[model samples]
Structure formats: structure tokens, C-alpha cells
Target chain A: MLTVKKASRLFKDGAAGFKNITFTVQKGEIVGILGTSGCGKSTLLRVLSGLDHADSGTIHLNDGSPSGAGVIFQEPRLMPWLSVEDNVLFGFKNPSKYRKQAAHYLSLVGLSEFAGALPRDLSGGMAQRTAIARALASQPSVLLLDEPFSALDAFTKMQLQDLLLDIWQEEKTTMVMVTHDIDEALHVCDRVIVLSGQPGEIAAEFKISQPKPRSRSDLSLATYKEKIFSILEYSNTGLQKYSVR
Target chain B: MKSKLNLIGLGMILPVLLIAIWEAAARLGWIESYLLPAPTVVIESIIEMAQEGTLWAHVSITLYRVGAGFLIGTAAAVFIGAAVGYFKKAEHLLDPILQAFRSIPSLAWVPLFLLWMGIGEPSKVTLIAVGVFFPVYLNIVSGIQGVDRKLIEVGKVYHFNSLQLVRRIILPASLPSFLVGIRSGLGLGWMFVVAAELLGASEGLGYLLVLGQNTSSPELIIASIILFAALGKGTDALLKSIESRSLKWQDNLQNAQ
Candidate 1:
């Protein structure tokens, strides 16, 4: 479980990106944060993952601190110099026991055959899968993804999405995925939060009220996708214009 | 198989062509037999030197100096480079002075070294050590710096402390550079060894070169030059084999799956 109370990230005492933002993501629930390109979606994810700190707010997370939270960037960020297995096992301090776990994750991502392959050899989708594998290898309690699959083709993206849903279901980990794709949000997330405009704050939150393993072709998902797009359109048109320097 | 023969053809053609031209020139008096002896004359001089066993004596002394100077110089370079690359304080303090010193050629230190240490093995070794230093240092520094920042971020995320960062990340990243430096240092060692020997040493290939000048034979000088060139090439080949083996992981990571 995670709770954010008035979370505002002000970089350099200038304009705050996220302002008075308050929301709670239930344990084992995948929440998608949808927003415009310049909105604080990635920044929010970074803050949650402890890569960047919240300027002011109480971010209450499970266990000790947010430092242990696993993070996957937009890029695969796998070390090009290491093999696929080695890259997967990078976070594992105990390679003897955890090396098998790396292999397991490699198989989990259907990359068991390419365990010897380097990052450069991987396709965009495959490399992102490896990045996902690397994140899961840490056995994270809370996984934060920052537009992690924006680079993939539609087919590979769907496959990875299914893989992620399977992992999330099995592990029951708290997942916060930031994405611009509304269909993706409706497909995987238990709740969808829309952040509005530049220097964004949470404008609307929607609980899917739908059951697990939701299908995109489902009528409910199609309706939710329309609702999400309209919510974004309304938020953008309604947002107050202010000069940001 | 056909391409292999072409490699062989290219190799055989150049030397055979050079030797034939050299033999012709000596016979035609286009080049003096004494000043620039034919290849055969140099071979005969090598036979004579072998008969007397004096060739090995000179060769042994040169090898000893080269080995001693190389080891000392390479060790210093690797250590100093790692220190400068890893520590901010060390870099700020040592870099400028090292840079100033590096600007002076290794041979430039010979006069000062000889004045201080005399025309002994110490001065000779000192010259070679200084020569070997900068290439290793610069290569190591650049290699460590060249390590992809993203790779370091992986370490940072894992909470690798400073010591572990150097051991797991910096050292491995800098090793290829360090090895290249050592190989090039060995090359520089030959220059210092022979130059020092030419100036003062009683034995060695360079001593033979100077001796030929005294006797005005040129054949013994040519033989010494060939011996030195062959030694340099052989050592380089040996280092290349070691480099290729040691960096196999990197090669696989880069080229293959």
C-alpha cells in the first residue's frame, strides 16, 4: 500500500511540478498515471522510486522506506557489456542462489534462448522485457515504471503487457505505471489517475470496478477508454494558463 | 584457403623483393658494401657473432634492462593512473605536475638522470621507467572516464560503496586501457633501453650498433637493428595474444550474442 499526502515536487524553489496531490494506491493494485507529454507523470514515478525526492509531502510506503522500491526507466538501461543472464542478475548480490532466479526471469520473459545475448542484440521490445526482468529480479514490493513500453510496437507491447499482468497477479506487488496510452491504462490498472497540464497535479481518479485480467475488447474497457480520453480533453481545455519559467 | 595463400604471398613478396634489390645494389656498388651491407652479409655477421657467443651476451644484457625497466614503469603507471582516476584530491594535486612532466619527452630526462645517478643501470632503468609512465597513465585515466555512466548508475542503484565501485566497476572498465598502456609501455621501454645503451652501455643490441659505427662495418649495425626490431615485434605479438584472451568477455559482449 502507498499513500501520498499533498505531494509537491518543487525543483530549485521555482514552480512546483506536482501540487497538493493526494492519492492512495491499494496493495496488489496496478495504477496507471495518464497525462500529457510535459506533465509530471515521469517525475511522479521517479519520486515514488526514490530516484528523485518529493520536495514536500508524506509518501508512506510499505516496509522501511521508498529506497527499496524497484524502478524501470523508459530505456532498458541494461549494461551493454554484460550478458543477458548477467544483466538480469545484476541486482542479485548472491549470484550463486539468485543466478537461477535470473534464469527463471529470463524464461519468464521468453528470453531463455537468448540468455547469452547482449543488450545491443535485443529488439526494442525484447530489451524492455529484459529491463522488466531486471526489475523483477530484485523481488520488489513496489514497482514503478516510467513510460516503460512507449518504444515498442503494438504486438510486442501487448505481449509484454500480458507478461507484466501475469507477474503482477502472481507476485501481488504494488505497481505504479505511468503511460500516455488510455487503452493500456484501462487494460491493466485497477485504478486510473489523470494528471492535468504542464506542472501537473492529479485532476481525476477512476476506479475500474472491473474484475482481474481485464480484456481491452471488453465493452467496459472501451467505455473506460472513451471516458479517459474525454477526461484528458476536458482537463487540458479547462486548465488555467500560467507562464512557467 | 585461397585468401590464406594471398596473405602468404603478400608476406613473401615484400621481403623477397627487398632482399633481391639489396643484393643487386651491393653487387652493383650503388650502395657501399661496408656502409649498407647486403642482407646476406648481415646474416653472415650474425653467424660469426653466434660462433663467438658474444651475440647472446649483448642480447641478455639488453633483455634484462628492458624487463626490469618495463616492470617498474608499468606498475607505477597503473597504480598512479588508478589513484588519479579514482580520487578527486589526487587528480587535482597530481594531474598538473604529471602533465608538466609528461610534456617533456622521456629521452629529455636522460641528461638530468645521468647527472644525478651516473652512467649506471639506475639511470638507464630510470629513463625507460619514465618513458613507460605516461602512455599507461593516460590510457588508464581515459578508460576509467570512458566507462559508460549508465553502467555506473547500475552500481549506484545497487548501493555499491566506493571500494566495491572501484573493484566491480572502475577496475574492469579501466583494465583494457591499462593493458594497452602496459603493452605500449613495453614498446617505449625498448626505445629507452637502446638509446641509453647507445650512449653508455658496454653490452646490448644498441651497443652493437654503436660498435659497428666504431669499426665502420655497418653489417653488425644492420644485424643489431634487425635483432632489436624483431624483439619489439615478438613482444608485441605476445602481448596481443594475452590481450585477446583476457578481453574475450568484452569481445563476446560486443560482437556476438
Candidate 2:
């Protein structure tokens, strides 16, 4: 489990980052942080991932280990010189000890054939899959994803979303993802927390009780999409009373 | 691979053509042989030197100086450049003075080095080392500083310590630049060796140039110049091959070609 209390990380006149945010993620739960651009979604994730320090609050991880969480950035960020398998094992203190697990992780992401190939040889989707394998190989208590699939084409994004769900079903790792894609947030997350405005604060939170293997075009998701759209519109328009009815 | 051979053949065409023209003109007595020797006459002079066994001694000694100087210079550059590149404090402390030293022509050190160390092997080698040092050092510093920040963040997420970060990320990330530095350094090393030999030497190709001048043998001078050209190109080609092999992972236009 992870908990953040009254966390504020602001920059440049105190209006460019997240402010006073409080949230908790339970074990094996998938939580999504959704927002429009410039709403400090990434800043909140950075604070949670401990890449950046919060100016006003504390983040507590259950294990109290600095390596307790693994992060997948928007870009694959693979070491070009490393082979796919070596990249999977890159996070381990002693890579040779976990050498066998690298194969498993690569297979999980369907990159078993590419284990010996350099990152330069891989396509964008393949590279991102290799990144997923790398994060999973660490076997961290919590996985933090910062728009991991945003750079992919629509088909690859949907495939990766399903792949993510499959991994969740198997490993049950706690995940906290930051995304701007409303449909994606609704699809894979157990709960989506919406942040709005400059120096972003939580505007609303929606809990989806739907089980796994839900259809992408389900009527239920469409209704939820409508609500999230209006909420995002309201926040983005900001007090200019315009009828979007 | 076949294309590479063709490329080599393509490069030799102009030089061969020019040599043929000069040889033809010399045979027809179209020019003064004393002023400019024919390519064959230069080749004959080189063969005569080789027959006397003096050519081997000169070539070997010059090779030794260049090799020793290159290694020493590169080792020092790696040490100092890594420190300057990694530590902000080190950069602030050392970079200004190093930059100032860099701007001075390396040849400017020749007279002072002779004065300090005497007109001996030490002075010659040290001058060559100084010439080799700057390119390698500057390249390393820039290479380390230019590493992608996003890659460093990945290391941080894994909780890598400073040393681990450098070993796992920084060193490998900057390797291409390091190789580039050494190639240019080797070039400067070749140039400085000639300067070193020209100033004070009993042997070597540069000494042969001086010998030819004193004896008024235009063929000998031409032969020594040819040897210098061959040696410089040969060493550069060796370094280039090493560079290409190590940097096979790069996604660049050269690889596409």
C-alpha cells in the first residue's frame, strides 16, 4: 500500500504543480490519476514515485524501501547499448542472479524472441513492451506508470492496456498510473481520481466496480466517459459560463 | 563488405592517376628530376633505405614514441575528464585552467619542454602527449555532460548510487564520444611526433627529411614524406575500425548506409 498526505510540489509563483493532494492505494489495486494537460498530473506522479520531493507533505510506503516502487516513463528510455534481456535485468543489484527471471518477464511481454536484440532494432511498441518487462522484472511492491502507453498508436495502446490487465490478474501488483486518456482510465483502473486546475487538486473520484474482461464499447463505460468529459470541460473552461449541454 | 572494397578502390583512383602522370613526365624529361623526383625514384630511395636496414629502426622508434605518448595522454584524459564531467565542483576548480591551457598551441610547449626536460626522449614524448591530451579530454567532458537526462532518471528510479549510475549509464553513454576523441587525439599525436623529431632527433622519418635536406637528395625527401603520409593514414584507419566496431549499436545514418 502507498499513502500520500497533504503533498504539495509547486514551482514558479506556486501555480505550476500539484498542491495539497492526499491519496492512498490499497494492495493489488489499480488507481488512475486523470487530468487535462498543465494540471500537474505528472508532478503528482513524480512526487509519489519519489523522483521529486514534496515541498509540504510526506509519502509513506509500507515496506519503507527506496526501491519499493518501479516506474515506467512516457518514453521507453531503454539503454540503447543493452540487449532486451539485459535491459530487463538492469534494475537488479546483481543481474546474473535474476537472469532466469528476465526470460520470464520478456516472455510475459511477448519479447522472448528479441531478448538478444538491441533497443535500436525494436519498433516503438516493442521497445515499450521491453520497458514493461524491465519494470516487472524488478518485482516492486508498487508500479508507477507515467503515460506508459500514450506514445503508442491506438491499436498498440489497446493491446498494451489488455496486456496490463492480464499482468494485474496474474501478479496482482499495486499500480498507480497518470493518464489524460479518459477511456483508458475507465478501462483498466479500479478507481480513477480526477485532478483539475493549476497547481492541481482533486476535482472528483470515480470507482468502477466492473470486473475484468469488460468490453471496450460497453454502455456503462460510455456513460462514465460522458461524465468525465463534462467534468474535464467544466474545469478547463474555468468560470466562463458556456453551455455545452 | 564488397561495397567497402569498392570504396577503397574508388579512393585510390585519383592518387594512382596523379602518380602515373608524374612518372610519365619524369621519364619524358618534361620536368627537372632534381626539383621533383618521380614516384618510382622515391620508391627506389625508400627501397635503398630499407636494404640498409636503417628504415626499420627509424619506423620502429617513431612507432614506439607515438604509441607510448597516445596511451599516456589517453589515460590522463580519461581520469581528469571523468572527474570534471561528473563533479560540478571539480569542473569549477579545474576547467578554467585546463581551458586556458588548451587555447595555447601545443607546439608552443616544444621549446619550453626541451628546456625543462632537455632535448631527449622525455621531452619529445611529453610534447606528443600534450598534443594528444586536449582532443581526448574535451571530447570526454562534453560526452559525459551531454548524456540524456531521461536515461539518468531511469537509473535514479532504480535507486542506483553515484558510482553505479556512472558505470551503468554514464560511461557507456559517453563511449562514442570517447572513441571520437581518441581518434582525433591519435591524429594530433602523429603530427606532434613529426614536430618532436624535426626539432631534435638522430633517427626517424622526420630525421630522414632533415637528412635529405642536408644531402640535397630530393628523392629521399619525397620518400620520407610518403612514409609519413602512409603511417598517418594507416593508424587513423586502425582507430576508425575500432570505433566502428564498438559503436555498432548506434542508430545513425552511417549505419543505414
Candidate 3:
């Protein structure tokens, strides 16, 4: 379990974002933080992953204060210099201990045949998969995803969503994904938090009523998506403040 | 086979035409063997020198100087280039001095070098080394410094070991630049080879030029000039072959996706 309390950030240009944002992700639960393009979604993800310091907030994990947390960014971020297996094995301090596990993860990602291939050889989807594999190799208790699947095509996205569910069910780790796509949020998240525009605050909190491994055809999922969309649409606020740039 | 035959035909056209024209001109007395030796006269002179074992001696001694000087000078330049490129302090410290030295041509050092090193092989080898050194070193340093930082960040996320980062990433990215440097350096080195020989030498093609000058034998001078041209062509071919072989991996890696 991971907790975020009173997270507030103020950028230099008097751009206030994420005001008094507080949330908790229960053990094995996957929560989605949904916002328009520039509601400080990436900043919030960065704060949770310890990549950046929040202005005034506390993020704490249960028991040992978060032994390890793996983060996947918007891009695959694979080193062009390394082979796929070597790249997957990068985080391990002890190569001997992690060798077989790396191979297992390689097969899990369906890249066993390309073990010796370099990152330049992989397609965008494969490269992102390799990045995911690299993160999972750390066996993190809290895994952070910041729009990791946005670049992937629909088919590949579905495949990865399924894989994420499988991995989450098997490992039972806490996950927090920040994304702009409401459909992806409804498809994968256990709960969705809708963030409104500048001086961003949690505008809506929705606990997904649908079951896991959900289909797009599920009525409850559609109900949740429509409900979230109506809330987002009610205010022309997030739209006006969401700058694509 | 068809392409190979086409290449052979392309290769024969210039040499055959030139030889035919030369023979006809000589036969008609339009050109003199004395002032400008015909291809046949030059070939005869080469044969005569070969029979006396002089041509082999001249060529061998010249190769010795070039091989030794190039090996030492290029190696030093590469090491220095890598170091200065990798370290900001060294680059800052050495940049001005290197620039100053670069302004002075290697041939300009000839008179002073004779005074210092006594016109020995050291003086001449030093001349050739200086001529080739700057081009290679400058290119190598630029290549190393020019690698994209974004690509390096990718290496960092993957946790690539430092040596692995340099060997696998840095070097390969910089190779094309380094090869260009070497190509230019080889041509510069060839030009300096004749200059070094002309200064003072007991043997070599350049020494033969001096001998021709002393005896007023334009035939020998033309012969030596041809030999020097041949050596330049041969060395360049060798360097290019090595370049192609070393860079062969790039094609596969770039096209693999």
C-alpha cells in the first residue's frame, strides 16, 4: 500500500497545479489518475515514483518504507547500445541471481527469440514491452506507469492491458497509472480520479463498479465511462485549461 | 559475372587509351623520351632498377619510415583525442596550443629539425607524423564530443556499465567521423612522404628524385614520381578496405529493424 497526502505543486510561472491532492492505493489495487492533457498528471506520477520532489506532500509505503519502486515513462527509454536481454537485466546488481528471471521475463513478453537483438531492431510496441519488462525485473512493490501505453496501437494496447492485469493478479503489487484516455482508464483501473485543469484538484472520484479483465462491451464499464465523461463535460473548465503543448 | 566483366572493361579504358596515345606519340617523334619518357621507357627503367635490386630497396626503406611513423603518430593522436574529448579540463587546456601548432605546416619544421635531429630517419619520420597527426586527432575529438546526450540518457536508464557505454555506444557512434579523419590524414601523410624524402635521405623514391636531379636524369625523376604516386594509391586502397570491413556491422544493425 502507498499513500499520498496533501500533494501540491506550484510551477515558476504562477502556474498552480495539483492542490492538496491526497490519495491511497491499497495493496494489489490498480488506480488510475485521469486528467486532460496538462492537469499535472505526469508531475503527480513523478512525485509518487520519487523521481521528483513534491512541494508539500508525503508519500509513504507500508512496512519498510518502499524497498523498491519501478517506474515506466512515456517513452520506451531503452538503451540503443544493449541487447534486449542485457537491457532487461540492467537493473539487477547481481547478474547470476537475475539471469534465469530475466530469461523468464523475456519469454513472458514474447521476445525470447529476440534476446540477442538490439533495441533498434524492435518495433515501438516491442520496445515499450522491453521497457515494461525492465521495470518488472525489479520486482517492485509499487509500480508507477506514466502514459506508458499511449504510443502503442489499439491491438498492442489491448494485449498489454491484458498482460498488466495478469501480472497484477499474479504479483498483487500496488499500481498507479496516469493517463488522458478515459477508455483506457475504464478498461484497466479499479478506481478513477478525474483531475480538473490549472490549479488542478481532484474533480471526481469514481470506484469502478465493473469486474476485472473487463471488456469494452461491459455496460457497467460504459456506465462508469459516461458518468466520468459527464462530470468532465459539466465544467468547460478542464478543457479550457488543458494545453496540448 | 556480367557486372565483373563490365568493371574490367571500365578499368581497361583509360590505361589502354593513354598507353596507345603515348606509344603513337613516341613513334611519331611528337614526344621525346629524354624530356618526357614514354610509358615503355619508364617501364624499361623500372625493370633495370629491379634487376639491380635498387627499386626493391628504395620502396622497402620508404615503407619502413611510413609504417613506423604512422603507427606511432596515429596511436598517440587517438589516445590524446579520446582523453581530451572525455575530459573538459584537458580539452580547455590543450585547445589553444594544438591550434597554434596546427597553423605551422610540418614542412616548415624541416630546417630546424635537421639542426636538432641531424637529418636522420627520426627527423623525416617526425615530419610525416606531424603532418598526419592533427587531422585524425581533431576528427576523433569532435566525434566523441558530438555524440547525442539523449542517446546517452537511454544508456543510463538501462544501467549500462561505463566501459560498456564507451565501447559499445560512444566508439561506434563516432566511427564514421574517425574514418573520415583517417582518410584525410592518409592523403596528407602521402604528400608529406615525398617532402620528407626530398629533405635528405640515402634511399627511397624521394632519394631517387634527388639522384635524378643531381645527374640531370629527367627519366629517373619521372620514374620516382610514378612510384610515389603508386605507393599513395596503394596505401589509400588499403585504408579504405580496412574501413569498409570495420564498418560492415553498421549496415546490418541499421537495417535489422
Docking class of 3: acceptable
Q: Tens-digit lDDT track for model 1 on A1-245?
A: 78889888865444436767788887788988998776788878877866678888889786544346777887888876678888888776666677789888888888999888877778999888898888888877778888888888899888888888888777787899999988888888889999886578887888998887876688967777787788788766665443331
Question: Candidate 2 chain A: minimum summed lDDT over ten consecutive residues — where?
Answer: A236-245
Instruction: Supply candidate 1's per-residue lDDT for B96.
Output: 97
TM-score of each: 0.87, 0.96, 0.75
Please give the range of 10 consecutive residues that has the lowest summed lDDT in model 1 chain B. Answer: B248-257
Candidate 2, residue B122: the lDDT equals: 94
lDDT of 3 at A241: 57
Q: Return the TM-score for candidate 1, rounded to 2 decimals.
A: 0.87
- For every prediction, compared with the true complex, DockQ reads 0.34, 0.78, 0.23
Candidate 3 lDDT for residue B73: 68
How would you encode candidate 3's per-residue C-alpha lDDT over A46-95 as one tens digit per residue? 77766567889788766332335777877887756567887787666565
lDDT of 3 by residue, B110-153 (tens): 99888899988898888888888889999999999998774555
Best by TM-score: 2
Error of 2 at A141 (Å): 0.7
- Cα-based lDDT at residue B81, candidate 3: 88
iRMSD value for model 1: 3.0
